[model samples]
Target: MDVSWEESVADSINTIYLLFSAYLVFVMQLGFAMLCAGSVRAKNAMNIMLTNVVDAVVGSISYYVFGFAFAFGEGSNSNPFIGTYFFALKDIPNSTYDYSFFLYQWAFAIAVAGITSGSIAERTQFSAYLIFSFFLTGFVYPIVAHWVWSSSGWLSPSSSDMLFGSGAIDFAGSGVVHLVGGIAGLWGALIEGPRAGRFDAFGKPVPMRGHNATLVVLGTFLLWFGWFGFNPGSFDKILVPYTTTSDQGNWTAIGRTAVTTTLAGSTAGLVTLFGRRLLVGHWDALDVCNGLLGGFVAITSGCSVVEPWAAIICGFVSAWVLIGLNITALKLKFDDPLEATQLHGGCGAWGLIFTGLFAKEEFVIQAYDSGESGVSRPYGLFMGGGWALVGAQVIEVLAIVGWVSATMGPLFYALHKLKILRISVDEEMAGLDISSHGGYAYTSHAEESQPRFYADYARLQDQS
Candidate 1:
């Protein structure tokens, strides 16, 4: 009842930011759909669609039911690992946040978890995938979210405790979102093994490019557009600069962060273009798209601190890093279709490390001063901060990789031992559409009465 007009306006703007961010993230679902449809075999077109569609649906339900609770849970008075209340969004205050903000975060949770589907594609059992998805969205993602973002957690803003020293700053979830998804995908890929014919008798990895490059390009663009929302919308604050006497100054820093994010992505993409050409015989559209994503991931950790030029440098380095990871993954014989291991895992780690190296102390002071105070607050390289910041980032990187690999590895191995990790060899060659899903994406052989269902119907119809 005592809220002023200014307070009301700020509330409204925060709500808008949340909604817009959520919408942008939601649009990324289409990008995933397009990207996966292109990455897999044409014969498995319908299967790819099924997996992608189910990710949004299953991921959303799981996140809403228990994922949100785990991620943002209030946690116990004693336990730092688990969340407390906030499950089912009970008793949430309308004044504290609008529906838009709530929805936006929800979309993000779904998108990050959905990335795993692409890694497990072509050979996974739909039932097993659904089960794994439920646990990931419901529990795995939430636990990590709680540790990093929850107020009560050790590393959260409330505690101001660093995972190492700089306090684990992920501006927009380079570690929380991308790294988690990538690591999960890596485990899945390793367990599933290569598709039939993807390996020779000597166990050499073969190139298994996507069935449709155009779709991959379109999906990549969609993801790029949606990232504008992903990075900029995290601020959850809208500052309208008013010259009135009542302390009317907008938070220009948020806008500056957004600009750096945009510029970093642009430069990262350019660097990737040249890097790919130099490394490979020709320029690849896929590499260009991924290079931009790598930049986005890199900038995400320190987008708020680094200058535009620094962002460009970060992007440039990430572009080459991405290329290196790709080559390394292939050399190591990792069967990562869509190269999720390189795009998210490798680049994401680089981004987190770079954030410590490049983040400015002024921004850290500003971010912390506005909210929390602590023993080892964030301090970056440009601020003449020592290697302490980098040291913290290193610990975080090791913790994430070690925990995820160790925890998920056993599960994948168990599944493999149970013979559930992969489909039969016949299924691999027959394609997922008919073998796994029981029908062609276009039309079922039994459904031929409906001529429109035929794959060749388009050409035949055109002739008619």
Candidate 2:
């Protein structure tokens, strides 16, 4: 075959690979919907489900209009903080990126909103959700993506003047996607406070378990399936040969990434299973599912560069990180219905730190495209690299926290002040489904009669 033909074939393969991955990532929306629906009380199921559906719908429009531009638009004069070109997706499908790339990224942007939705699930007003979801996907999340994932980003590995000679290595956005969403959720939940009756008058905890375990398991498995694409699919091209004569290429690294992701999630699930058993004297499937997700969140930063063994370590530590955070949240009376802040925020921070400690030299070189640049980038500290990578990773954590706090924190607080964040107490007691939406998710003859019975009772009391 001619050289031009070979190049064409390579481009076609890469495009197909990316489109397939985008589909897989989009399937995660179903996973998020099912998981959120299962985690909240039955009374609020419909409300939470609707928010999850709207996350995708609203996020798509906002991200397409400006979020993608703020993230990856690189003109001749590119800035480190944010992109200035490609607004409204004009001039896209250019030399640098294609529509498939945009589709894949849109899937990710919506996932951030999905994560935040879980934090304030049961008590939040539908209107408040609409406002925050639009702002986050359009602005807050994109800025962070620009800082970490964009080529011109100051924290990006592809940056010209890298931080500490080694920019933050968030290979798959543990910090960018998970941490941003988690922190945003944290502020929203904090401002809204816990669901009604979530705590006793004495400030002690109350058990507000989800209404469905089957849906939780179904969602967890679906997320696990989608993660195959989430981690390995981040490699936009799979057809590039590593060298002219070598058989190895990005395909090998992609497989390794998939393996590491699986191992980390599996290890975290097992640890959470036994650990929770020891702590609470019962094997809880829900804890295992969250632990598994926490593992995936932590390993997302270093999944491409870490060894399989290191991924296992990442999972184990992440499980405990989640458990400890949950305990602390309870103590502080911070009630997140789905533990989004703990699982994503806390574990995602740990994932970035884990990458700084476990990333291997050869894998880092192969994964990061630093070999051609002749720049010997820093690897993990424990791998004998130095403090440079560690320092850079720490900077990324602090910057994400600060940025999300400054943007999303105040957005939620303003919503609270406007008296539109949470529902009224009577509405909360009656449940969002009945009070806000039309009715309950599940209904029966008995349930149908109860509403009329309550109406009659109230009427008689008023007359008397």
Candidate 3:
């Protein structure tokens, strides 16, 4: 097809914007690392950090090799369950736009892989974590991506079996990335079991607070910052090339998505704070942090489709979900230190549902019509009438949860039966930094040797 110079310029500009957006998404890896690092006990700090680093490394290599193919290859011609083309990405064009799109999606893939680390923190063997990261990124994530995001996906409105409405709408990845990651995380936590001392002989859960509140707060802020890129960038909203009359609506979705994301996160944080104080008689920083994230996850699916007011409602409800799930995780005794099972998995499911209940018909028209595919998506019942879209969402979320758990559960079970998943009792007590990596993260004033170091420091200060 012949193209005008203006269209060529637009594509080039969009490519650049996408590349930059991917870089912003890439920084989220650091956020996940720090957040998970701070959420674990002092002994497992380095271990969690290592798991994140390896996730990027392994995730990148594996996803590059075949993951993208399974997710995006063959595009419209792709199979329903998975893509059959682009093995080793051989079919992707050499153009700047294609590569930028590839890189952006790759960043999302890594974040999904990293989410599970927090749930299985502390007791997870580094080898097991590395292996799971490889399979999850190279195989599991890509398959799910194909199921929902790819044009041929059955859950897509464009699919032949869009059983409900345009299949299902996950503006970003509430179901594709977060929910899938959460279910996988929960499965690993359940199979790996709780950390030593996490439960007593009476099976009562014990409190195990993280060693660094500062890091947790910092991590939360960083995640929030990167989320700007995570949500708005999905639509490739660049101001320069997007000035044309036709592109204005795309720009609006981008702007509104960003606005919704910010409002959702802020409202979720405040709601979580109030809930914490009301329930625990004190405001808890970590709960607030998780609440903020839960809100983001919840609004992600409908960021472009839902109004800001709806975003606030989702955020508020997300905070409630986060708090409830955290308590439930403890009650279930899964030993999930990060409450990610609820934050991402539970809230991600809610994010999709939020889209079904509140997505505006006009906004959905703007987003779906302006989308690169030029597809007319199914609308929510509240906006267009009928329960098709919302019901599809419920089915989609359950299917994703069931698929991830069923796949990851057996893999973890095999690893468990082989005794390669969890660490030994001695290693659990000694901390993963020293046990797995053969060293302490801090040696000068060793955290594990705090009593001895503090006593000596007091004596020296007295002499001074």
Candidate 4:
């Protein structure tokens, strides 16, 4: 075959691979919907589910308009902090990136909003959801994505002037996507305060379990499945050969990444299962599911570069990180219905640190530098690469925390001050489904009558 024909064929295959991955990632939105629906009380299920759905719908428009531009837009004027090109997808499908890449990134942008929604799920105003979702996907998240994934990003491993000779190796955005979402959620939950009845007069925590365990399990599985695409598909191209003469290629690294993800998540689930059993005296599926997701979040930064055994260590540590955070949150009387802030924020930071400690040298070269030999770059600290990579990872963790706090913290605070961030006390107590959305998620004759019955009873009591 002619060289031109071969190049065209390769391009077609890569595009197909990326598009398939994007579709898989998109399926995660459904997972988040189910997870959120299952994790909240029956009264607030509809409200939370609505927020999850709007996360995707609203995120799509905002990301298309400015998120993609601020993330990966490349031109002579493009800076490291934000992209100035590709506004509204102008000059897209160019030689460097195609539409499929945009679809993939958009899926990621929406996932960040989905994460934040979980933290402020039951108590947040629907209008607040719309405003924050749009702003996050349009501005906050894309800037971080630019800082890590874009070529010009100072934190990007692919940058010309690498930080510490090995810019942050967030292969799949443990810091960028997960940390940003988690920190944003942190500010939102802090601003909104806990849901009603979450704390008693003594300031002790109360048990406000989700309405459905089945939906939580289902959502967890779906997210687990979608993560295959989330981590492995970050490669963007599966056809590239690692070495011109070697049989192994990017395809091999893809498989290894998938393995690492699976191992880490599985290990975390098991650890959380037993750990929680020891702490709480029983097995909790919901806790395990969250632990599994935490593992996935932690390993995402180094899935391509870490060994499977190292992934297990990452998982093990992440489970405890989650547990400790949950305990601390409770001690502080801070409440997040879905534990989104703890799972994503605490474990995501650990994942970045884990990558800095355990990333393998050869694997790093293959994944980041396209297996180009003789390229002097730092690797994991434990692997004898020195403190450079770990230092970079630490800087990344701090920078993300600072940036999200600066942006999202103010946005949430502003919404709170305006009295629009959370629903009214009566509306919250009655449930957002009936008060805001106009119906129950699982409506029945009795369920429908109960609300009216309560209204009449309250009116009668007031009259008496």
C-alpha lDDT of all candidate models, in order: 0.73, 0.90, 0.83, 0.90
Q: In model 2, how large is the Cα lDDT of residue 20?
A: 91
Clashes within 3 Å, all models in order:
2, 0, 4, 0
Over the stretch 72-115, how does candidate 2's per-residue lDDT look in tens digits? Answer: 88765457886765574676555434888999999999999999
For model 1, the run of ten residues with the poorest summed lDDT = 241-250
Model 1, 84-187: lDDT tens digits are 54554764566357356557767777776567777777888777677677777777766666766666555554454555545667767787778878898899
Cα misplacement distance, residue 175 of candidate 3 (Å): 0.8
Better of 2 and 3 by TM-score: 2
lDDT per residue, candidate 4, 134-251, as tens digits? 9999999999899899888999889988888889999998999999999999999999999898999999999999989999999999999999999999999988887634676789
Candidate 3 lDDT, 216-254, residue by residue in tens = 888888888888889999886464422225546566678
Report how far residue 459 has shifted in candidate 1, in Å.
Answer: 28
Q: In terms of TM-score, which candidate is stronger, 1 or 4?
A: 4
Evaluation by lDDT, superior candidate among 1 and 4: 4
TM-score list, all predictions: 0.88, 0.95, 0.92, 0.96
RMSD (Å) per prediction? 5.4, 2.9, 5.4, 2.6
